[model samples]
Target: QVTFSHCVPTIVQMLLNAKAAQGTDFKGWKITIGGSALTRGLYDQAKARGMNLIAAYGMSETCPLISGAHINDELLKADEDTRSTFHLKAGVPVVLVDAAIQAADGSFLPADGSSQGELVLRAPWLTQGYYNEPEKSEELWADGWLHTGDVAVIDEMANIEIRDRIKDVIKTGGEWLSSLTLEGLISRHEAVRDVAVVGVPDERWGERPFALVVLGEGRELSAAELQAFLEPAVAEGHINKWAIPQQIAVVSEIPKTSVGKLDKKRIRSEIARWQKEGSAEQTSLS
Candidate 1:
């Protein structure tokens, strides 16, 4: 079994090389990918090697593995696109667990799939409250449900696909761009080791996405290649052309919080410092 908590291309390459060296037929190998969004390219590569790949979805609050793809005959016989869609989806709710989407005002939305709202869950196993923090517990359950702090869109099949964190959605030029989406896309490139996408001030576009990339050791890639790779996605309307990011800065590493999530506050501070110093060499990517 192979898993990718984050979509690191080098790890994918290692898996492919190992598979080739083994020369063993992939009929029995089960490769399950989770944690971050899996790219179509990586999914296709694993499929070509005859490996059984599945997608799993969960979070730390849910004890992980809330729901996972079933390798049943029905799913196995599905078309490539269907399978890919399933792979991208968050999957159905597990038995004995209840989930719903709620608005900011604490009203539940209908399961119509078009409504965008915060995810609220009720599972028997979830923690009753934060340890030694009654106030925090009350705040978390203000609406009588476990507020997951995640924004998601459910489909007709009841598959909950996470869109972005409510706070991470950047409003630029009358549209919202998911930082998670941009990060996932940028991390797919071979040169990238770690990436963080954030919205920075723009005189024209209101707020534009900027990528802070930590390149893999000994790998060199230009900004033009990254732009070109994202062009097709823009053309396909997956994201706005303007959202393709105005700049890509190759940094040593991104600062992270103690919990390991990208520390956007630090990046914002760095950008401000650079702007104030008039550091043209470090600030300009083009």
Candidate 2:
């Protein structure tokens, strides 16, 4: 009986599974996925199960509607795969909004599409600053652009592909690894129902990617199995070897925020505590 809804991928997954188990299907329900990056695995799954999954992106500061997926008439009759690719992106800039990526060197990258940088934006309707937080406000509007903290590549056609958050990018073995991209790739695994990837402190590499995965019902997923599955992609140059997660933890559930986004801040804190405890234990053993 539902026609339209907006929810994160996890909620959509749970809802679709529940309907399937009850011998029913969604009535071509339209779902707009946000709060976190939407993986193609989730998009395909929802489509296969009779749901239209649209990818959208925004933050609380921008009135929350900066971009969304919208296929033009020409692309409407195109193949499902082609259309799905567009639908899986963070989306183009909305009206009256100007989106640009700021390179690490502080240069404005071109829209030719190869560059990946921090997404900075400007819009008339965007909130100028946080309430009563002068220091944070100045930081937010530094250099005359609203820093989104999201790293993305914006194509010439204005197609915006969000790769990762600046703080969440994994720097291991002296190369950058995108946690969001890793999560998307790992989610393609049959046994993976949900996953969260984070950068953990490492003395050798500074920071290494650590993943927490939730397995599908009756699915037995092992670290080796998952790593082996990802090896082919690495060999294919689809991802760097260092991009493969250093550690993968299979957990019963991943924590979520009140608004249903991945609680990565909490995860980082927990990982730090566990690492400290492990170090103490090793010292005792020695």
In the range 206-276, model 1's lDDT, one tens digit per residue, is 78887888776688877888888888878887777887876778877677666445677787778767768
lDDT of model 1 at residue 49? 72
RMSD of 2: 3.8
Cα error, residue 226 of model 2, in Å, equals 0.6
Q: What's the TM for model 1?
A: 0.74
Residues 127-246 of candidate 2: C-alpha lDDT, one tens digit per residue: 899889999898788687999989898987798889888888888778777889888889889888888899988899988888888888889977889999999889878798777875
Clash pairs (backbone) in predicted model 1: none
Deviation of model 2 at 247, angstroms: 1.0
lDDT of 1: 0.69
lDDT of each: 0.69, 0.83
Q: Candidate 2, residue 140: CA error in Å?
A: 1.0
Worst 10 residues of 2 by lDDT: 277-286
